[model samples]
Target: MAGLERQLTLRFLAEPADVNFGGKVHGGAVMKWIDLAGYACAAGWSGKYCITAYAGGIRFVKPIHVGNIVEVTAKVIYTGRTSMHLGVDVKAGDPKDQDRHLTTHCVLVMVAVDDEGQPTEVPDWKPELPADIELRESAIRLMEMRKKIGAEMQAHVDLQPSLQVP
Candidate 1:
């Protein structure tokens, strides 16, 4: 249903503290903002506290300099039995300029939790609009890719001499 958007946009300035030695914001700091934005969106949608279950590959496309206006947008693109996949994008630009540079983009899965901190069921999200449908399809494709990558990584781990469980 195309109703209230389970989305959140956070705008802030990249302070010096957020910057690294190269005078650019650290990737981890941006990721934290992304996670927080996702959490806010997930909590609002599920009506329960949500935790980050997974954050997909995030590659920094451009460096965000200190004093730049940073904008992060997180929106629920797809939902499963208990999880929501949020597509988050980070952009930054000078206040005087109209251009907003795309810094990174990633898909995050947030799982709702109960009072006891256990995973709880969340409402399903049905895509109606064309953009929403496209996002949902992308989410499913990303999920499958993650599964395959996880399996491949696990297989490699199993071959490691020091990583054996037994």
Candidate 2:
């Protein structure tokens, strides 16, 4: 399925103690930003409430310290009956240094739900337009990664071989 793009920006000063430790931002804090940004992207596309089902390929490329404004951009790359794949890129630097380097990136899968809290269908995405090439590529890569992870997990489960009850 095809999806859309959404972005959110928060100045470094807005981040408080929850994200800072010894004047440096924590990894968990960075993850929170990813999730929030991804959610917004999914909601913007789905036009409804979306819940995070899974997040993968989370990599921390750099550390964000106190007083560094961070910008997070998220986009929906794929959509399904009730699920959407969102990609989030995080960067940090002084406002003056607009060249902000990428600090982290990840793909999150979210499912749209109705007010009754049940999964709901969303419009299918079509990437025939040239502008959607990037999003389409991202979704393809995410799908590939998900397949690999699923295979590894299955292998691990097979190795365990559950015991039968008496």
TM-score of 2: 0.79
User: Candidate 2 local accuracy as lDDT?
Assistant: 0.78
Candidate 2 segments exceeding 4 Å error: 1-23, 128-131, 161-166
How big is the RMSD of model 1?
Answer: 2.7
Quote the positional error of residue 113 for candidate 1 in Å. 0.6
Model 1 accuracy (lDDT, Cα): 0.90
Name the lDDT value of residue 88 in candidate 2: 80
Clashing residue pairs, candidate 2? Answer: 2-125
Q: On residues 1-166, what C-alpha lDDT tens digit does candidate 2 reach at each position?
A: 2244344454454255745546678888888888888777778788889899998889999888677778888876677789888778888888666778888988889899999999998767766767677787878777887889899999999999579897
Candidate 1 Cα errors over 4 Å, as ranges: 1-4, 163-166
